[model samples]
Target: MSERMIRVKDIELCTESFGNPAHPAVLLIMGATASMLWWEEDFCRLLAEKGFFVIRYDNRDTGRSASYEPGRPGYTFEDMADDAIAVLDAYGVKKAHFAGMSMGGMLVQIIALRHPDRVQSISLVSTMYFGPGWEELPPMEAKVEAFFNSMGEMDWYDPQTLLRNAVDKWRILAGSKHPFDEERVTALAERDIGRALNYSSSFNHSYVTGGESYLGRYGEIQTPALVIHGTEDPIIPYVHGEALRDSIPVAELLTLEGIGHELPPAEWPAIIGGIAKYAAL
Candidate 1:
């Protein structure tokens, strides 16, 4: 694997890749407030072994990527979508299979709609549709809502406090099916916080706005799509996956039973297997 900084417009994004560049490319976009490390190195390697060139990157305001003032992102969600294209361009890849989680999934949808030619296939995980019907879908569970609301009270600057909050967030999102791996979660949180340029800037994702309306446009996507959602997802209900599957012409849903809004180590094999099959790599 190799890591490099690639320029996109005026900002630089940090990217890491696995496997042969000659193989089919799969760009993995992580969720909001998360760096490429959330994609997990071992997960990327396992996917690479399936004959795919896997690319994962830090989105703006996370990890080693560019950052802005905490409350002012200065870029729209659409610009972030364009950043994906820039990453592909930096790698000399004209087209790639895209896999994204949570907010990353939303970006994939935008890319598929806005730049169809650059996408091969899409994998949307633990996210809801962004268009018109989104309001009708179930809201996040009460506990999850409360947790996000409570973020204002936490101290983001202190490493120990940040670590504790991160661990707590993961625990809440892990659902009831599997045992919560506190040790593993804590270690990852530590690394993510340790490697960031300005970890606090990640919160800017909440304020990002898009210039265009994607209203009722899900049906316009003709590319093959795989919508993966945890049955127990608190942030985005399972029905959102069903909505994507039904709206997209060539989309299929992969239900992660007993899982939550997370990509736990236990589910990596299944998730990887699903992607390999879906991408036909």
Candidate 2:
């Protein structure tokens, strides 16, 4: 695997890749406030072994990438979608299959909507489309809310506290069937903290303002699409995935039984296979 910084517009994205570049590409987009490492090195290698050139990158304000003003990100979601396309252009890839988790999934939807001809296939995992009543959606599970709500109380300046909060948050969202992996969670939190340039700007992700709904455009997407979600996902919930599947005319839905928000190792085989099939690899 190799890592490099690719310039997209005015910002630079820290990107890494696995397998041969000559192979069909599969770009993996991580969720909100997440770094590319969330995609997991093993996961990328698995896809590469399945005959794909896998690419994963840190979205702006995360990892080794450039940082924006704290509490205020000047760009919009459309710009982030364009950043994905810019990454493709840097690699000289005309088109590639995309698999995005949570907020990343929302970005892929926008990418497909804006640049339909540049997408081969899309996978929306643990995310929902924006609609008129999206803001009025029911509150998250109590434990889930409590877990995230605790973020405001933590000291962001203290690395140890941040890591503890990160580990605890993942533990709460962990699937009951798979249980929690303490060692793995610890490693992930440490890696994320180490890679982050501006840890406090984590909240900037939620502050991005002004974006239109994709609810009316879902059916207009011509690319083959897949919606994968854990049956027990606490963050986005399974119903959101259902809504996405129902909206996209040619979309396929894959529900991982008893799985949660995080992509555990058990669900990878099905998720990777689903993306490969959707991309017709």
Candidate 3:
């Protein structure tokens, strides 16, 4: 794998790629408050081994990307969506398949609607539909809600405290089906915190503003889509995936039974295989 920084507008985004550029490109966009590291290096390599040019990048305010004040974010979600395009442009990839998790999935939806020509396909993971009818879906799980509500109490400056809170957050997100791997999660949290330009800045994602409403436009998307959702997902319920599959003209759902809002290593093979099949089409 190789890493590089690409300038987009006034800020820079750090990106990493695996496999040959000649292969079909598959861009992986992680969720809010997460850097590209969340994609997991071994997972990327496994996907690349399936003959794809896999790419993962840090969203602004995460990893080595541009950051803003803790409570203030200079850009909007629209800008973040465009940043994905900038990554594509920088790599000379005119069109590529996109696999996004959570907020990243929302960005993929926006890109497919706003810039249809640049997208070949999209894989939505642990994310809800951005258009109409989302309000009627199941709300966040109570435990998950409580965890997010308590985030303000965390002392971001204390490494140990941050690590503890990060692990706790993952424990809630991993659901009951799988055993919580505290050591693994802790190591990843440490890596994320240690490699960031300003780890606290990642919280700026909570303040991002100004994205044009995609209301009632889910059917407008023409690109083929794969909606992957964990049945036990606390953040985005399984019904959201069903909504996407039903609303989009060319979309299908892949349910992960007994899974939660996370992409655990055991699920990588299934997820990667699903994406590879969709990309081939």
Candidate 4:
């Protein structure tokens, strides 16, 4: 059944809880500035069907949850990890499987590192470990700054805009032959940003602040982790996934040769299968 109106540290996060509550829980964390809605209905249902009590919530600054300012120099990725942990505490959950995408993946890494006792396993998708040389990680300084700064929101009077946007991003991060499904891209844009502002200063600030960068600590994780990356992913190079796999003990890697940075809904079967395999362990 769907759950509603859960409180996580004063922020009213929208959560969807399904399947047996008695089963071990799986926390579904969305990417940076992305609403929990972007997790996609079919994928969430698939996880629920696997005897997992799934919980997907909006981050503090995204969706229906509270948005706090950096409120000092700024908030880092560690703060995001704390937010995820706080959600589990609010639910009174002792431990859970952690799944995240993009920045969400980084937060899950932090959560596993900081609160290892609370994690059963981890599944990270389209992510990177920002080891040393983060400031110099290719694409030139000017392009990198502009890339993070230009994630503006858009309206869908013409759906092609969304397709164009996805293609453009993939082109920059992946080579031209890298394929991305148009429908999934549109759905992601619709579910996550169809109603909210296109961009947030806080998200931009958080990115530049290096809150999501991980440097040389992947070997420290003791949990089972499944890292999935598209071979053609543009935004996060596939090398990031390989590095994570090499760092995390017992971590398995899934590389989709034809896919781009955006993993499509059509691939839910394979994605859910990978998650289920890890969750079973």
Candidate 5:
């Protein structure tokens, strides 16, 4: 069963943890503008059944963990990283294997850099070392704006409409070429609305080089790591996959051809397998 709490400045958080406590832990870090529900129940359970103590939760600004404070400066990724640390602390865990997707992937980089001892291994999926650029590849501003627009037109204030909007966004991000379970996404968005941020700070951090200067800090990470990305990812070019692999001394890269941004249901077996294999060592 999933549990919930208010943490780090009274922000609500929803948590789902299972499997043998004696087994190694796996902490899942989600992507930008995402909630814990997006983590998917089947995925989490699979990890648990695979002999892992799996932990997944909603970030402060997403899902049941949200609270709006306009005067509060949009939370920085650094602080967000700290919040992630707080989660581990709350659970009384000294360390665990971490697997992050997109923005969540960036958070692991920070943890591996700033709190190396707290991480057993790293798995980065569809994430960039830094922010996406207009020159390298145009930001998905239009699609994101369209998401906002569709919400407004559907009167997002209504819970059901907002859920539909959230589901649609997931479908689109999945490229809609693959089968997506709308019911799951809808429930995720439903829980997500309560944790929605009207003006939450996102992806804004002081970067001397890029958001994920983990490249420079790579040598500090003494743990094994893995980098996974889709070959057809338009948001972050496959070059990042190569870069992350090249930078981390003990990292391996897995490039999936034709896969889009989101992890599809069809690939869960391989996804869980890859992680279980790495965490074993």
Candidate 6:
């Protein structure tokens, strides 16, 4: 894989590409506050090996991408969707299969809704169809409380604190059947901390609210879609994935039996294979 900065609209996106551009492209978008690295390098290569040119990039505020204030981002969610299009434009790809996790999944839905002509297929993993307050099904009360309480205690000034927080958060959200890997999570947190801006703009994703209505527009999506969710997901309930499957006429839902809100390392093969098959068809 090769990494570089690509200009998208008025901002520059840090992007990593795998495989030949000549192959069909699969764009991966990560969740809120999470960098493109959340998609995992090995996972991208596996997809590429499955005959896809994979692209993963940091969204506006995360990673090595452009930085913004920690609060209100100047752009809207539609603009976030457009950022994906901009990445495609830079790569000279007119239409490509898209996959997103968490907030990234929401962005892909917008991309399909607003720019149908530019999407070949879509895959949403561990994400909800609805925007922030509009989720069809909300997460468990205890989990929600845990998330907020943890965030409240986080010392954003110390990157080490942020890394520790991430490790703890993953443990809470990871699938029960999958053994949590402290070492791997630590490595990812360390890498992200080194590259992340001093003041993170992750909260900006929640502050921007215009896309709340996009959930109502799922009926307009005609592209083939695959909705994958963990049956035990506590952050975004499995019901959210069911809602997406029902709302999109052509969408398919896959439930991972013992999984939670996270995409565990063990599930990569199945997830990547599912996306490749759906996109290839």
Mark the regions of model 1 whose C-alpha exceeds 4 Å error after superposition: none
Better of 2 and 5 by lDDT: 2
> Which segments of candidate 6 are over 4 A away from where they belong?
131-136
- Per-residue lDDT of model 6, residues 31-116, tens digit only: 88888888889989989999899999998788888888888688888888999998999899999999999889989998998889
Q: Write the per-residue lDDT of candidate 1 for residues 1-281, one digit (tens) a residue.
A: 99999988788999999999999999999999988988999999999999999999999999999999999998998999999999999999999999999999989988988899999899999978756678888999999999989999988879999989889999998877789999988888999999999999998999999835653488898789999999999989999889888888898899999999999888999899888888883
lDDT against the true structure, each candidate: 0.91, 0.85, 0.91, 0.71, 0.71, 0.85
- What TM-score goes with each of the models? 0.97, 0.95, 0.97, 0.80, 0.81, 0.94
Which window of 10 residues has the lowest lDDT sum in candidate 1? 210-219
Query: lDDT by residue for model 5 over 1-281, one digit each (tens)?
Result: 45747477656566768777677889999987677666788899898999888888876556556544433435666777777778777777889999999888888888888788898999998877543332464354466557655543565346666566667777666643467777766666665675555413221222212333543466667888888887766566677776777778898888776766788877777778888888887
Off by over 4 Å in 4: 69-74, 132-184, 194-214
Output the worst ten-in-a-row residue range by lDDT, candidate 5: 199-208
Off by over 4 Å in 2: 131-137, 213-216
* Tens-digit lDDT string for candidate 4 (164-250): 654455345433443545555555655554444332422542543544344457777889999998776656777778878877888
RMSD in Å for all candidates: 1.2, 1.6, 1.1, 4.3, 4.1, 2.0
Q: What is the alpha-carbon lDDT for the whole of candidate 6?
A: 0.85
lDDT (Cα, tens digit) per residue for candidate 3, span 4-53: 99999889999999999999999999999999999999999999999999
What is candidate 3's TM-score against the reference? 0.97
Model 4: C-alpha RMSD to truth? 4.3
Candidate 5 residue spans exceeding 4 A from truth: 9-12, 70-74, 131-156, 175-177, 194-216
Give residue 120's lDDT in candidate 4 (0 to 100). 91
The count of backbone overlaps in candidate 1 is 0
Span of 10 residues, lowest total lDDT, candidate 4: 196-205
Query: Using alpha carbons, what is the TM-score of model 5?
Result: 0.81
